[model samples]
Target chain A: EAGVAQSPRYKIIEKRQSVAFWCNPISGHATLYWYQQILGQGPKLLIQFQNNGVVDDSQLPKDRFSAERLKGVDSTLKIQPAKLEDSAVYLCASSTGQVQETQYFGPGTRLLVL
Target chain B: AQSVTQPDIHITVSEGASLELRCNYSYGATPYLFWYVQSPGQGLQLLLKYFSGDTLVQGIKGFEAEFKRSQSSFNLRKPSVHWSDAAEYFCAVGGKTGANNLFFGTGTRLTVIP
Candidate 1:
């Protein structure tokens, strides 16, 4: 089976510029997630979507970051006015809606803000 | 709130040597624990997870982790390491609440010497 897919494996943007990352999850998966992994750190959950609805986004930076999964199969995460601190790998993952189910991840979009 | 901690930032081990990576968690209730490995320029892959019943869980790539409630620790171990095992390892904890979002630690980078 094909795994989760993401676009633009690498990205570079100037500070204060805007950037967007895309994710297409595994087939039939009901849950999707976006995470940020800074250098030398583990991935941190930025948002989660169950189908077309958001399940959690408490950690998301409301002022600069936003994400949507309109049809439940694909997702897009956007960061406006990007900062140097936002330089990180943005990872996307999907799971089968069970708390215990293992999540499948995609090759992340490595964003470097200069 | 839930959190995970990986004490080691980096570790070096010779091929065919036994390896152990430490993890600790802090949560109000019992948590679902996980270990994930990320190769350079790749996505995170599930190594193993522990939900209930078994304290020791075996995973792909000849990896295993033992969940210790008393110590609030889940350490990954490999009986015989391989050069391919060189990657970044993350420890995470998931709670029942909030869409089961995972809390992850600062990762542990493993370097295998042949």
Candidate 2:
């Protein structure tokens, strides 16, 4: 089976700029997730979706970050007016939508906000 | 609420030697735990997870972890480290319902020397 797919493997932009990352989860997977990994740190959950609705996004920076899984298949995460602190790797993952299921991840999109 | 702690920031071990990485969590009741490995510029891969049943769980790439409820710890272990075992390891905790979950640690960087 194909693994989760993320676009724009890397991106660099000046502060205050906007950037977006796209993700295509593995086929048949119904649960999608977005995570951010800063340097020297582990991935932190940003948002989670079950079908087309969001299940959790409490940790997401609502003022700057927004994500959506419109069709409940592919998803997108956007960062507006990116800050230097936003420089990190954005990872996408998918699961079989069952409780305690294993999550499969993508290659991730590295963002460098200058 | 759930939280994880990785006591070690970095660990260096000689190849072919035994390895163990420590993890601790804070939660009111039983928690679902997971270990993931991330290579440079790549996404995370599941090493293993503990929900119930077994205290010692085996994972991919010759990795294994033992869940100790008495100590509130889940540590990864390997009998013989391989060169490719070098990566960043993260420990996460989640809820039993599997929604709005996965609190991760800062992570531990592992380096294997030949």
TM-score for chain A in each prediction: 0.98, 0.99
lDDT of each: 0.92, 0.91
> Across residues B1-105, which tens digit of lDDT does each residue of candidate 1 receive?
788989999999999999999999998887889899999999999888888888999999999999999999999999999999999999999867532688889
| Segments of candidate 2 deviating more than 4 angstroms | none
Model 2 per-residue lDDT tens digits across residues A1-114: 789999999999999999999999999999999999888877888998998899889889999999999999999999998999999999999988888788898999999999
Best by lDDT: 1
All models, DockQ values? Answer: 0.69, 0.69
